[model samples]
Target: MAAASQRKPATLQFFLSAFVVLWLIAAAFPFIWTLWGSFKVELDFFSISDWTNAITGERTQTTHGSPFTDAGYYGAWIQEEFWRNVLNTTLVCIFVVATSLTIGTLGGYALSRSGYKYVFWLLIIALIFRAMPPITLVSGYLPVFFDWNVWGFLPTAIIVLVAINQPFTLWMLHSFFEGIPKELDESAKVDGCTQFQAFRQVIIPVMWPGVVTTGLFSFLLAYNDFAVTSMVLAEQNRTMVPAIAAFLGTTYTEGNVMFAVAAVVSATAPLFILVMFFQRQIVSGLTAGAVKG
Candidate 1:
């Protein structure tokens, strides 16, 4: 009886595992297919025999076509549109990440250590900003930039993105700073370090995980942002997503493999780079060495 019961549960577990695996594959296919299809040229792409369509269930044949052109993998990262978007993305992310990380960390540390009456008021203000009034907020900045002839383009769009992300980063970093024990700072003080030295020598190193987390969020905010970027931004300075939107000028190929390829690679690149660089801190930092701390 015991053996039969155990076998029944094992059977259930096996089926459940198989279902989960298949579910994951289904969910991931669009993303994987987009990346693969991005490299394919036009002809090889729509052919029912193309492997590009084969795995994606768009077509049911395994008939091999030219490996890359059919697979939509070659021209993706090489194209002018893709590179343009990449440059725009790089500029925006640099501003967002740099400002958010620096300000968030400093503000977080201050909030953590201080009981100043003004700090209480600032925290409230930060919370309101994080609510993200995209339309209203953009409206506020539009006239100012427009008056200065800075609206709808390069430098101004970048600044608007930084403003959009600032509050969330500050909030995330503040919580991280609060989680750190104050005792460490006190111990550093007893050892003759000043506040700045203690933060530099002791707190900052320990809070690296949190810093990375905050930075990742900041990076993603700028990277994935579309609505505000689209609205606040004008014709010429479109980022990768909007830049791709430009190609949607009533062309059939716009819906074909090349466009998908560009979309996937361009959009995912910064996110991939950030995750690659901060893989350790992001994984470890959410909890931030809490066990040992």
Candidate 2:
């Protein structure tokens, strides 16, 4: 009986492990396929005659004299000057993340510690603004931008992105602040630390994980933003997402689809690396409120 029971559990465990493996493969297959195809010519990657050409790279080998080629990357990065868009994106994300975190940390800490009734109302107002679609917000800003002649600039997009992303950061950091015990503040005070000093020294050190989590989220918002960047920035000031869209071509313009494919891979690779590097902090930040500290 004991032997039979052990065999049943072993079989179940094997099946569960297999299921998980299959699920991971299924989830990862599209990205893996895209990554592979990024190195091949469009003919092989999007072959209608033989789907196997994608895997075999037959057409790619014929064209490039090798199974893999850097033509797509070169075309996108060098020929199309996608690097400029990437630089623009980097600037937007940096400014957005820095500005959002600075304001969010201070505002969140204040709201979390304040014993006033208006704090609730303030958060509610922020939530309302956050819930609105970004496009709608952009439309309202457009006329003003045109009047001010600030319509198509990196700073304009950064300002809008900061506005759009601020509420979520405030809410997230506020929750993180709430999770921290009040005793820390009191202890700091006992040690002759002023409120600002306590916040800068004692609270912020403990709040580091939550801050990182919020900053990463803010970075993603600014990084991936298309609607606002597309509308607010001029052709030369376009960011990566809008530039990738341009590579897709519209009715009036011819696009290099392969260039877009390569750009997609380039843009996505960094996100995976960032998440992996900060995985621990993300987890801690998310779970900070679950058990009071």
- In terms of lDDT, the best-performing candidate is 2
**How do the residues 114-193 of candidate 1 rate in per-residue lDDT, one tens digit apiece?**
87898878877977887866777877777787798877776676667777777777667777788899999989989999
Clashes of each: 7, 0
lDDT of 2 by residue, 159-196 (tens): 88998998889888988898899889879989999999
- Best by TM-score, which number? 2
Give all TM-scores, in the order shown: 0.75, 0.90
- Please give me the total number of clashing residue pairs in predicted model 2: 0
- Ten consecutive residues with minimal summed lDDT in candidate 1? 57-66
The Cα RMSD in angstroms, rounded to one decimal, for candidate 2 relative to the true structure is 3.5
> Candidate 2: lDDT of 244?
85
lDDT values of the candidates?
A: 0.69, 0.89
How much does candidate 1 score in TM-score? 0.75
The deviation in Å at residue 112 for candidate 1 is: 0.9
